[model samples]
Target: MMTSKIIEYANNLIKLTDEEAEQLSNAFKEVNIKKRQFIVQPNFTAKNRYYVLKGTLMAYVVTDEGHNHTITFAIDDWWITDYNSYIFQQPATMFIVALEDTIVLQIDHEKEHDLKKSNHKFETFFRIMAERGLASHQRRIISNLTQSAEERYENYASKYPQIVQRVPQYALASYLGMTTEFLSRIRNKRVAKKS
Candidate 1:
């Protein structure tokens, strides 16, 4: 039942034969995490990629200065992993924590490799997912480099209203590369403009 959501997600991207669907379903196992629980932490190998079934998760890193920099957030139908660690089979530099009580379907690195080897469709599906993730990261990098803080905040809020509404203000501020107080001021300005 947890796998059903993943099957539907895959099917939306590429037509899956009945057998491929069954294979994919079997490859992923369900996991439940409590709020604030960490699914991946620094120095541990990130062996699985998770597909969110419900609730929210955030991936972030703590700097030497003790600042937490949010890398990304995942909600229902989204995938979350430290791709660098997962793909390279190296220890993770990030922490992936559940922002809310969460359920996810996860595929281990070995199992995913086996699935891709077993079918071209599986390989294609993963490749497409990777490409899209890469594009999103590149876009974020460009935006951070070129946009003003207010422009960045406005663009991200407009594009991902759900994330803006669901995530804690501090976490969202970190993700947008702004301080929490600055974000609060920006938000107040927006509210005043609307009023």
Candidate 2:
């Protein structure tokens, strides 16, 4: 079911015949990444977009202050890339790394272009992903600007419970733009509320 994850993702936006699914899946090359490995580094061009088949990958950047900020994470059935760099063929300012030993299906620019040209459904699927990414980023910006820390954490927990389980708390805290100690307090408050 290596392809099943992507096939299912594709079908969510646009229904495809089995034959089309197979064709779309064929564009990917399987890659295995070791824990702590860097997939794409700052100042390098990101060659491919990866679909997570198992384990996790993170996209992050180190600030001038020498602190890492988590930009995004991808788990099973999710997509991960230094997206702006990949799309525009520019050098990446972010890093993409394997958080755990991982399996992924990767597609290069040529293959992606070919796949999209071959199937309108593929084009629609990617368009939807782009639109959703934009919407999610907008919501996150609004949440950070307006929501209290507790409210933000609760909203994220409800929306992406799987991320809370799969990612380290410190990384999640960074992604939430909070201190780890603050996140710890939030977690404690959440536990107290549940009880």
Candidate 3:
């Protein structure tokens, strides 16, 4: 199955057997979502971590001023969740939405913990995932504090060219913590330089 590939990647890292892989896959439930649909909304509880089998999704926080601050993006083979909510069993502060037609496999909190208890490899996989997530979030924070908006945009473009191509300019601007107009000017400047 599609989710097996994701589990396999972790399995290989933690040396899980085929039986474990089968159990892991069986624990997940698949679902599809249309573009512009919400998977989770702020103030509600987030029950599962969604693994993307296809398409894209994003998590963001919207302020009273109505500005969206993009937290993260999930593409094929990636995972999306409000970790704070999931871990603490609290209401989510972030909104998770589909950017395109999406297919995801989700494992609920209970199943996730059960899997870890059942398989040492699963525990290792989750540990590695958390570490990588922390590292990525740290990079975002450092970049925001140290880099110019244009530089940050450039780095994001370079690092996630696929997302850059797929996401709207406005959304990208929000993720870069800049205005759409400024992002447009940056794009224009790049275009002129290329000319």
The alpha-carbon deviation from the true structure for residue 80 of candidate 1, after best TM-score superposition, in angstroms, is: 0.6
TM-score per prediction, in order, is 0.98, 0.94, 0.96
Which candidate comes out best when scored by lDDT? 1
Q: How many backbone clashes does candidate 3 have?
A: 0
Clashes of each: 0, 0, 0
List model 1 lDDT by residue over 44-92, tens digit each.
9999999999999999999999989999999988999999999999999
* lDDT per residue as tens, model 2, 1-195: 687778888888899998998998889888999999999998999989999999999889999999999998999888888888899989999998898999999999788988889878899889998899899889989999999888889999999999898889989999999999999999998899989
> How well is each residue in 1-195 modelled by candidate 3, as lDDT tens digits?
676776766765677677887888888998999999998888888999888899999999999999789888999888899999998879999999999999999889999999999877788888998998899999999999999999999999989999999877888899899999999999999989999
Better of 1 and 3 by lDDT: 1
Give the higher-lDDT candidate: 1 or 2: 1
Per-model C-alpha RMSD: 0.7, 1.4, 1.2
Off by over 4 Å in 1: none
Each model's lDDT? 0.96, 0.90, 0.88
Runs of candidate 2 with Cα error greater than 4 angstroms are none
* Residue 105 miss distance in model 3 (angstroms): 1.2
Q: Give the TM-score (vs. native) of candidate 3.
A: 0.96
